[model samples]
Target: MHVVAIYNNKGGEGKSTVTVGIAEFLAANRNKKVLVVDLDAQASSSCALLGRQSLNAAIREGRTVVDLAAQLKQTRRPSIDPEQFLVWRAASEARGSALESMAMLVPDGDRMYDVESSMVWGKHNHLFRDWLKPKLTEFDFVLIDLPANVTKSAMVCVNGLAMSDFVLIPTRSTHISLNGLPRTFSLIDQVRNVNGDGFPTVLGFLLNATDKRNQQYRSIVRPMVAASTDGEIPPFFQNHWPASPALEAATDEDRDARTLKERFGNAYDHARKVARELEVACEKYERTQVQPIKLSLWQRLGLA
Candidate 1:
């Protein structure tokens, strides 16, 4: 499986929207089995995929990333079966049958704070990644929606980054939002430096909530953003998501059923195009990137 983390240190950049939209498109259109892991304590992606009611029920039952993270902390313990927390066919059945292959590991908003406070970064660093690598071989993609502002959830973000094979940044086109890109890259660099081989690489930037008429973005920030990447990967995705009420509304998780097209409304094409770009990135990363040798906990900790 090709694991991906949809992340940005800045908030309100539409990371969760991109995560859910791309996951649905990949599962429904590309015929890929997708697993969405909601690492954010906010659980926005989980609620979007499973609806608030189901997500709440799962949270009540202690079936969430918090539970998984807590369990994985005990290295001596047997692996917890992924199915225990995985919600199969997570999207609304009313949406379409195409999302049958989509699933999610919901999050707990209530207990995540306490969980993160207790976490020792080293002990939990690669625990989740190693536990998942062998058991989730059947999945085609694992899309992780990481919490914004790395400082707030460092442990969870580190683990998410270490688990992912690629990181897709979704950023708003505004100057403040664009300014956060460097920090995101800096954190990724730190993860790569410490984690060593197999650390996630930058997939590219997916501009979200863009204004087509904004000359500032078209003339200044856009090229500046592209140049910042130094042509490492495709600096910016060819397809971007524009700001639209319809697209924002799609994040709502109601009992009402809606097809993918109906859900995205006028933004259907945008979502599909973004998803296609993501698929291409995944294929390229898998084909050209070197596979990392599995390392023991002590090795990763520099204790061996």
Candidate 2:
């Protein structure tokens, strides 16, 4: 499976929206089986995919990431049932029966905060990675909606990056969001230094909520992102998500399921284009065989 982490260090950068959009497009249009692991304590992706009522049900039934982490904290072995944790047909997108293959690991922010606070990273890191890998083998793509404040939830963020094949940074076309790219890159570098070859390579930035009329996006934010990377422009997707009422409205989910066309409306084309770019980006990494971290027998047996 191609494990992709939709991440940005700064909040309100449309990470969850991008995660749900790309995941739905892949599963609904590209005929790919997707598993969205909601790593954000906010659980925004979980709610967007399953709707609020379903997400609340999952949280109540202990079918959240918090449950998985709490279980892992008490066990050295993979005792938790992965299938039980997954919510099938999670996206509720009525498109060609492909969304039927989509699933998610819902999250509860309140419980997640407690779990993160209690987590002993050194002890749980590899165990969490080993446990999650096998559960995700059935998927074509595993998209993790990572938390914004990585410092506040360092344990989960570190292991999430460790398990990912690519890290796709989603940023808004603004000063605050674009300026945070350097810090995000620094954190990725630190993770690479810690995990070495196992760390995920940057999959480039997906500029969200772009306004074609605004030249500032091109004139200002573009240069800022380039400067952050030491004068070399980062790989930005050619197709950006345009600012639109339809796109903004699509981010909010209700009890009703909607087709991609119905939900995204005119912004459907924008989503499709960005999703296509994402697919093309993954192909290069796959050909190069950017391997995710695999547990050795010693590590699996808790010897390493």
Candidate 3:
């Protein structure tokens, strides 16, 4: 299975929304088995998918990622297998698909699973890598929705990236958000260094919540496109995910009665385009081939 992390250092950059959108697209349209691990304490992704408030609620009242790890380390007791901890639920029945048909495994419980700051590192440092070795053939992808900032949860995100084949960085086309790219990239570098694996290559930097009419967006897009041409960053720049009222509306209410494909036609169309780009990136990465140049570094750096 290919693993992908939807990450960015800044919050409200549409990271969680993009992550859930992609998971839904893959599961509902591609008919692939998906596992979404919500490592954030906020449980936004978990709520979007399973309607669970937190990860702890799914693990029964007595267990947590930390509790299991401590038990395993302190008492030499075998902790709960990661697979058993999965909460299985159907995707929205509005699409006429069973929960089992979409996600093969999800976090199980009612409260939310919160990753404490202390438990973020080394809970299963190499455990995910080892655990995924045998089960890699079971699914098409394992998508993780990381917390917004570089905290302990972010470190767990890096661990997920270590095991993943590609990483997608979602950002807005603005001075403040774009300015923080270096730090986010640095975090990825640190994760790769710690794991002794090369940095997790970006699938692409997705420009989200963009307004076509804005002069600022055009200004930003021009330079970013130039950078892709110059090879300052990987050339897997996907299509922009336009800002839409439908996205917010879908997020606010349960439209599960309608297939995501049917409820928001325009939004799903954009998501499908993004998914197509992702497939190409995944294919090239899997084969260890270089991505073709599409834009210049000047454009990528937003200096064009």
Candidate 2 residue runs with Cα over 4 Å from true position: 90-101, 224-233, 255-257, 287-304
- Higher TM-score: candidate 2 or 3? 2
RMSD to true structure for each model, in Å: 6.8, 7.9, 4.7
Best by lDDT: 1
List, residue by residue over 26-106, the lDDT tens digit for candidate 1.
Answer: 888788889999988788888777788888888888778888878887667557788887877544456353344578888
Worst 10 residues of 1 by lDDT: 294-303
What is the Cα root-mean-square deviation between model 1 and the actual structure?
A: 6.8
Order the candidate numbers by TM-score, best to worst. Answer: 1, 2, 3
Native-vs-model 3 lDDT?
0.61
TM-score of each: 0.87, 0.86, 0.79
For residues 17-50, write the lDDT of model 3, one tens digit per residue: 8877777777776777777766565666666666
For each candidate, what is the lDDT?
Answer: 0.76, 0.74, 0.61
Q: What's the ranking of the predictions by lDDT, best on top?
A: 1, 2, 3
Write down the lDDT that model 2 would get.
Answer: 0.74
